[model samples]
Target: MANFIDKLKPALAGSREGPPTSAASRGPSPFWVMVRKEFGDHIRSWRFVILLAIVVLACAGSLYASVSALKDGQSASAASGEGSSSFLFLKMFTETDGSLPGFLTFLSFLAPLIGIALGFDSVNTERNKGTLSRLLSQPLYRDDFLNAKFVAGLLLIAVVIFSLGFLVMGMGLFTIGYPPTPEEFWRVVVMLLITVVYVGLWLNLSLLFSVRFRQAATSALCGIALWIFFLVFYGMIVSLVGNATSPADTAAASVVIRHQDWMMLLSRLSPAYLFQEAASTLMLPDTRTLNPFITQDQAYLAINAPLSFGQSLLLVWPQVVAIVAETTVSFAAAYVAFMRQEIRSRS
Candidate 1:
């Protein structure tokens, strides 16, 4: 009877010759395999395909729109007098200027949508599809799963945002019939960086929301609601507060507003707004008016602020650090939340 049972055990265990297995000897550690499998799964996902398609379409659309606008300008340029062709084209784009305010407005509004799309179901879908426990049982740190999601999200943003900027520049040159000037080139570069950061910031933001909520519907709704509040309602409320607190006297109003500077300061707290301010500083001339706080004098001072790009980097290093810090804190909280969740195997 013992011999027969042993023979049956081998057949049931899939080899008829293998040794007994134990949890302690699963070969690779959990963390590495999760990361490895995650990378593979990321590339193979429908999300990846959608991301690529969105990138191509969004960039192509922007290029087409800008070029069509530029082409319409070309006919008028030949007939009417111009101080300089470059100057005229500059004026048109200046109206369309890639200043911080403009960049922030466009990117802040656009990015949350991308964030929602990428993260709304990141974990819940896995949980619903019944892969969560099996994935958790693997030899990986609990945090690794979240990390893989973040890495994939950021990489996708980098690829898409970068291509958009390059295409915009190419279309600009085609329309202008000359390469961008030194100042113009920096503006475009600044625009590109902020676009990436804006999109990437929301990657973690949306992911954090996704992980913290259990019901897929709850997560998706919160993710989108948070985006709306931050992007649209935050500004509106800030403006309302400013208005509600305005002084009775005109002179006091101006002076108090200047002294408080709360509106401008409050604006900076929004990564969206800060990104705009930074972009404005990078892209606009000394005269650009992105914020009331940054006057012509302040703008000039910033431009002439005895610093190389490296030095400026160090100066704005706080903002960069702040962004990193915020993303890290949110993601860390989400990581802990996920690790604490009950793992039920549905499949």
Candidate 2:
């Protein structure tokens, strides 16, 4: 009887193993596997750790300044009956005690650093180390490898940005003793998403450089140089163009508005400008338009009435679309370049 049971066990085991597993039942796809590996690498990398530390410290300092300012403003707000506390939650992002800039200011300056650091060496470094050829030598397709790298970096950016944004919101809730309205909460979520998109623009740009340049340092420098150009020099160039194209001093209001409109269009070419406009409008409901030149009609409009969340979103929709378009174009360029590169193994 024991021998019969044993012989049956073998048959049962063979039957269980008889059916071949389909691809879907096999483990995760190669693309996802590579994504996980790259995401883990970014989290553990020293550069990422250093950048995150700097960002966290900056957030802490700005939050402290903002909270102190808000507390001081409370008395005036209560006495005036202006109900400043209504949007108190959003103010934490745009308000500061003058010693340090607000949260948005810090984020605008530092977020790009995070993106650039994560992706500046993504492709070239692997190639230089002779790992690129070996990685492609496996079951991984070129698209999977490239897409995984970008997707992993994007996931990391989302994690970092969303975490910090919510951390600030949580701290504000505790410190201010005021829960955000649903509208304010949604606005904050949108702003954080915009921030992620803005950072992704830089990430994709760096990825493009990594694919184009053989040396990681060259790619990194190119990324930083472009950042510096937009942050510092681009505004000056815009100003010069605006001035050169300035209308006569006695020009009609319509003419002046057109000139200003053209300047606004030119400035929007810079992603930094687009980001600032979007962040400010989203966080501050009082903003009515992106135009710097206020027409007489707008000047006569009431100042105390803040736009609803939907309205604010509509106002910034173009800026948001423009940033997304730029990011997509950059990633597409990188994809094409990387796919065309020849992979060679080296000792």
Candidate 3:
């Protein structure tokens, strides 16, 4: 009986080890596995931890300032029927401290850094370490590698942005003793989504630089240069060009109007400007439009009547479309560059 049991055990072990599974047929889905690995890497890295801390501290400071300012304003206006505590959540974002900018302003300024930091070294670091070739040798395709990096970075951005936004809202509720209206809540959600798109454009831009440049330092410098060009220098350049091209003081009204339109077009070319216009309009219900060409009749009609959520969305639809287009173009450029790149490892 013991000998027969031993024979059956050998047979069972042999059956269990019939054939080795192919790479494609074994393990988890490549895309998801890659995504999980990259996402975990991002969250565990010191870069992400430092950036997250900085952003959170900035947000906390800004929120504290805003709440204090709102409290003072409310106390001063207690006698009057004005300064109702409506849209407290929006106010937390838009209200300033007289000493510091509001929460939205901080987000607009610091958000680009998060995207750029995550992406600037994404590919180059692997290449520098001679891991790119080995990584590609796995069961995963090059598409999976690139897609995982992008999707992981995007998911991280969404988590950070949404978390901060909700934190602000929670703090505002406690400080102001009021919750957001349904419309205001939806507006905040839309603004957050728009912000994710805006940061994603920067992420793709950085990723493109990473793929194009072999050295991580070169990619980082190029990414920062592009950001500075658009954020700091683009507006000045546009203003100079507009001034040079504008009609003389004696020119016809139509000619000056055309010059103004051209200036607006150039300004909108800056992603920062587009983001500000869209976010401001979304958070501030009283804001009707960012256009400079509002006629007297139109201005009068908009007076004292806050735009509804749908109306505000319609006004900013073009800006939203432009952001999406810019992001797509950036990602496409990175994809093409990475696909065509050679993957060689040191001997």
Candidate 4:
């Protein structure tokens, strides 16, 4: 009996349970299990909690501001009062149906925060946890881990965006004391779609950083640096070049016509900016103004040379494709890096 016990203990030394895991026991779609596990791990992190808090706070601010605006509406002499609570809230919260400027602006402004949170430590954490080798050991295909990470990040994005949008919508419904019209709902949906794409771009960028950097902090800083370059300086460069290329004091028609070339050239360079413009177009169908370029008439006129809804899609296709393709490339790179990485040399 003693001899048998010693032999059994040796067999079970590394096992977590009674039975050895067989291919059959591994079950169907291990990728899903991996994604869910990643999701769970991320949601529990302080970073996720903080990110959710920011979005929740934004929603709450909208509601509180709406309530204040409502309480102050119609008191013109109140000095702090706006014309209407509902009006201001609608202006601030409503998606630009055929305009992408404000939504893109918001995303450009907020993207670094999201990107840093989602992927700052993607590779290093596995290395630190001593799980990279084991994760690579799973019987799934070579790319499954990478695929699972992207899927999990996307799910996280959906949760954050929809939650904030719904919260704002709820407040609007209550404060205005009426349900959203179909148009508004659909506009919100488009805005949400844009949000998904915008966040995806950042996630991909950060994933690249995650793969290339050995330290989590270095990856995070590099990700943020990239965001700053694209969001902050990219527009400055665009505007400067556009102005440099332009003729001054032209008629509004010619101003638009001539500037359109420069602006399109400028905007296309950054998917972040293009996404903002496209979001405005898709979400703010009824927008009276989107940035300085789009007037109420121009918003729907296809004047920016979109030519058609299909053209608009084509114009923004790079942003959409960049996001998905960037994610695939980054994840693939991470997989390759992990597979080739020597675990023994890892610190």
* Candidate 1 lDDT tens digits, 35-112: 566556756788767765765565455545545555556556655754234433233233332212222244446665
Instruction: Please tell me which predicted candidate would have the highest lDDT against the true structure.
Output: 2
Task: Report, for all candidates in order, the number of backbone clashes.
Answer: 5, 0, 0, 17
Which residues of candidate 2, in runs, are more than 4 Å off? 1-25, 79-83, 301-303
Quote each prediction's TM-score: 0.72, 0.90, 0.92, 0.73
Candidate 3 all-Cα RMSD? 5.1
Which has the higher TM-score value, candidate number 1 or candidate number 4? 4
Question: What Cα-based lDDT does every candidate model obtain?
Answer: 0.63, 0.92, 0.89, 0.65
Please provide, for model 4 over 1-347, each residue's C-alpha lDDT reduced to its tens digit, 9 standing for 90 to 100. Answer: 75998788868776755566676766658899889999998898888888778756655654555455444443543565543323233444532322233323454477547756797787677877778777666677656776777779888887878777777777767776656556557656666776776787677667767767788989888888877888789888888887787766655776666577668766666767666666656544433333456555666764443133344445545566665565566656766775665654256
Best by TM-score: 3
lDDT (10s digit) by residue, model 3, range 1-347: 75998789888988877467766668778898988989999999999999999999999999998998888877877868576766767888989758788998988888988889999999988988988899999878898898999999999999999999999888888888878899999999999999999999889999999988888899999988888888889999999999788799999888888899989999998888899889999999888778788778887876687799999999999999998899889999999999998889832
For model 1, the superposed segments whose C-alpha errors exceed 4 Å read 1-44, 47-55, 68-105, 181-190, 250-255, 258-260, 285-291, 294-319
lDDT of 3 at 217: 93
lDDT of 1 at 60: 50
How much does candidate 2 score in TM-score? 0.90
Question: What is the C-alpha local distance difference test score of candidate 1?
Answer: 0.63
